[model samples]
Target: MSRKPSTSHFLLLLIIIITVAVSAARTSAQSTSLCPSSSVNPEFCPINCFRPDPVCGADNVTYTCGCDDALCAGVRVVKLGPCDA
Candidate 1:
């Protein structure tokens, strides 16, 4: 005779699946949130004008021309100013 699964067992499995899904989503978000320096591609970047609006990048480097330069450098801005000395 085949044994039916218990309600508690099903609930536990469901909880595990939900937890795994949430964890995976968070991991994906975190990984995508930061652009590594190795991915820097400045080919399409706008010309670096004389503008000097410094923005701090997640890599602790300062992008003196704001987010445009930061994105071109494959870096995520951490703040809107130069990194602390």
Candidate 2:
């Protein structure tokens, strides 16, 4: 006969599964929302259009811009090169 899982074992398994699912969902959500909508062309408004916030890193600095929507907030990170006048 097969042995059934104990209560503690079942609870642990449940926790692990939930954690994995949540982590996966979070990662996918981040990837989607981290980039601005392609419909918004940056060429039209170069200076103030794509406002990016700076994030410091060990080797290079990164910039992130969030969508200031009425319901939800989203962010996009872009690498800034040399500034042109």
Which candidate has the highest TM-score of all? 1
Off by over 4 Å in 1: 1-43
Task: Please write out the lDDT profile of model 1 over residues 1-85, one tens digit for every residue.
Answer: 9999999999999999999999999998887733244343578686455879888998999988777788887777888778898
TM-score of each: 0.47, 0.39
Candidate 2 regions exceeding 4 Å error are 34-85
Model 2 residue 75 lDDT?
Answer: 30
Instruction: Report, for every candidate in turn, its global Cα lDDT versus the true structure.
Output: 0.79, 0.46
71 Cα displacement, candidate 2 (Å): 19
Q: Over the stretch 23-43, how does candidate 2's per-residue lDDT look in tens digits? A: 999998777543345454444
lDDT of 1 at 70: 85
Query: In model 1, what lDDT does residue 35 have?
Result: 29
